[model samples]
Target: MIPELAPAKACAAKVLIADDEPNIVVSLEFMMKREGFEVLVARDGRAALEAIRREHPRLVLLDATMPGMSGFDVCEAVRADADVRSTCIVMLTAKGRETDMARGVGAGADAYVTKPFSTRDLVQQVKDMLAKDTAARALATGSAGAGELPKDMPA
Candidate 1:
């Protein structure tokens, strides 16, 4: 029998939830924390950008319709900044039109989620992104073998 491999450790990646809605903030916070992410909450778009610049979270769940700055603005700024361009951004929006989706992608958002989305799917997506990021970093640093396949890789 092959030796047992150690179970994957809970990810310590940082995630920022940028939304003005109190209920959404609380629910997303709870879900992310339960999945072992260190969470930061930003109640406005400007605040979200500030938090991202200061804290440098690996992932952000950004609301599209925040006061002052839109999620598109935040995504564009993050993508433009070399220091934080690698940060994965998911644009959360009530606007589900194809144009809205195009706008989000144009602004450099890595993913887009509708307002009424599945928490399980979002959580899993976050987890997968974090895992992929970690593996990429490891590979970049030459710590992990190049032959190793990420768990989510298709056969």
Candidate 2:
């Protein structure tokens, strides 16, 4: 419910942020807005599940560690939900351990980025996710445009 990101004001593409730390959520919300993404914040995994049900954001940035319903649990819930399973998920955490990465992968996150990540990287990741989603939808709707097929389709 904090102030929305600036760039997001124009495009209005929604993004969900799940993290326990207030400062991290605030900073990411501001940065995502500056990069043109509407931002939603959930302080814990249960809140994140509710937001996903209500808002259905294009992407979710999930923190691996939280007081309740850890990121892994959240990810599992999302993956299980048919309505929001396709939502792009990027894990955020201070823990860079190899085992942690394995667990994140096991949880079915689409992408994983460590804490202290560069703002540029985060913005690019969002853009890439949106573009990928657009492409996927186009393909699913059989509307890759007239005289055009998906790049991977046999010519």
Candidate 3:
């Protein structure tokens, strides 16, 4: 008789949605949950930052304008903290101006996606970003295949 193999464990990736708008939060929460992500939410920037530090989510969908600290502030703080600096941040805001996008990137957000975004695109982007991050980490830890360099590295 053949021996049975145990199933591999799968850990769902955590995604934090930081937004003050109740409707937006509800939709995002539902979408993320449907996409198999473990969703965490914060209604304000302060709470968002607190959650980020405490929970260490794999990704953050940050709103630019919020009561208290502001998403830019939270992004900067996360980037400055070495322990959580690697956490991916995607600024999802109504502020669609080029200057605002620049500011988000300046503050260390991995991606800045304005509001009114396509949910399908957003989900794909998140998956791609997480995959890229995982690959980078694997390369940094020398677990990536022997002759391959991370995409960002010069040939």
Instruction: Please provide, for model 2 over 1-155, each residue's C-alpha lDDT reduced to its tens digit, 9 standing for 90 to 100.
Output: 89866642234678999999888888889998887677899998889989988999888999988877899899999999999998889999988989999899899988888888886788788877877786888879877896553443211
- Candidates 2 and 3 compared: the better one by lDDT is 3
> Which candidate achieves the best TM-score against the true structure?
3
Task: For candidate 3, write residues 93-149 as lDDT tens digits.
Answer: 999999999999999999999889988889889888987887879868977786654
Instruction: Specify the poorest-scoring 10-residue window by lDDT in model 1.
Output: 146-155
The alpha-carbon root-mean-square deviation between model 2 and the true structure, to one decimal in Å, is 8.7
* TM-score list, all predictions: 0.85, 0.83, 0.88
Q: By lDDT, who's the top model here? A: 3
Q: Which residue pairs show collisions in model 1?
A: none
Poorest lDDT segment (10 consecutive residues) of candidate 2: 146-155
Question: Which runs of model 1 end up more than 4 angstroms from their true locations?
Answer: 1-11, 146-155
The alpha-carbon RMSD values of the candidates against the true structure, listed in the order shown, are: 5.3, 8.7, 5.1
lDDT tens readout by residue for model 1, 1-155: 99999977544678999999999899999999887778999999899999999999989999999998998999999999998999999999999999999999999998999989988899999888777787988778777676775542222
In Å, residue 133's CA in model 2 sits off its true spot by 1.6
